[model samples]
Target: MASKVMMTPGEILREGELEKRSDSLLQLWKKKRGVLTDDRLRLFSGTSERAKELRFHSILKVDCVEHTRKYVYFTIVTTDYKEIDFRCTEESCWNAFITLALIEYQNRRAVEGFRRHRFQRVASEEQQEEPGEQRALSPW
Candidate 1:
């Protein structure tokens, strides 16, 4: 069984700063469906075959319970899954499916990028200020 962390929208909104490789998903959520942008408009499919093989465990099994106008819930039984949404299905199933897994992955990636940019900006400023060997490490 995979461990899951259920966070409310309020909790996600309260993050003040992003850590290295952290959650910048909130920024990415400027799209229509929050973080998971409509790939149809982006002219891309939501899921890729490699993403499925890499994300899903060998023993993983998914069954879609409902696909309504609002949201779709998929009951996924897996061995070890990091908190993510919308993974590709196995044989006999076509196209990507909606699951929490894909949302999590996109969120993580977006956050990580934001953090990396933040660090880069900080490091650049430090480099501009320091003129000697002290440039190697700036406590600030």
Candidate 2:
């Protein structure tokens, strides 16, 4: 069984400021407060409310675009096929944080799925072995 900390969702893993590339035509760089949780990565502006959310369930993968002297660039690819670009200082390691969190989320999901499947199989087997139930004999 997985530990409580690894299995639990909604736990805050990392939080910091990151610069994201805008999705509009101008495609300018905008600052965002990024929060990496066990299940999702949320981006917020100066306001208290979240501006954008990329849930782990909807995220396909995170890829490194490039790494420069000052910044490490990366992209978050969503399940819907949308690409979101971001960059942060090399020391900050925003990209690494997100990638690790995403991997952990995926692992948790896989563990849950395996557990559910195993439980269902066990329950089905138990039903077949119910008390007072008898197996049919061969005609031969």
Candidate 3:
């Protein structure tokens, strides 16, 4: 029989070596696909004081940049997570967002690698649709 072990967002992030890997902050969005404990979600969702301090709400989005035949790069969007009317200290929020962004980037990198190996003939704009339309038809 296998024993069950629970994981936290912090643990997952730390295990990936996200902090030491780059100068920027990192955040990984582990949804239903990844194993996450309720505690981890609570920590990430900012229900507790510690979570709030981490600036969980400061994350806006993560963008992956794909270069031809090159590794995908991640950029994290930063915002103020604080709900008060007053302005937040730029340093704290900025750092938090960056950290989260880095983690998310690392996570994306792993996923992208897995997908590339699993799927052949990955859809590209050039291959999927006919010319003359401004936008390519996305299966999404």
Name the best candidate (by lDDT).
Answer: 2
Give the Cα lDDT of each candidate.
0.37, 0.89, 0.36
Error of 1 at 74 (Å): 12
Backbone clashes in each candidate structure, one number apiece?
9, 0, 10
What would the TM-scores of all predictions be? 0.30, 0.85, 0.24
Please state the error at residue 113 of candidate 1 in Å: 0.8
The segments of candidate 1 whose C-alpha lies over 4 angstroms from its true place after superposition are 1-97, 132-140
**Please, what are the lDDT tens digits per residue for candidate 2 over residues 41-112?**
889998778458889999999999999999999999999999999999999999998998889889879999
Clashing pairs in 1: 24-111, 84-100, 84-101, 85-99, 85-100, 85-101, 85-102, 86-99, 86-102
lDDT of 3 at 112: 89
Q: Relative to the unseen true structure, what is the Cα RMSD of model 3?
A: 16.9
Q: Is candidate 2 or candidate 3 better by TM-score?
A: 2
Clashing pairs in 2: none
Show where candidate 3 strays beyond 4 Å: 1-5, 14-55, 80-140
The 10-residue segment with the lowest total lDDT in model 2: 131-140
lDDT of 1 by residue, 68-108 (tens): 55444344444574322332224312123323344454566
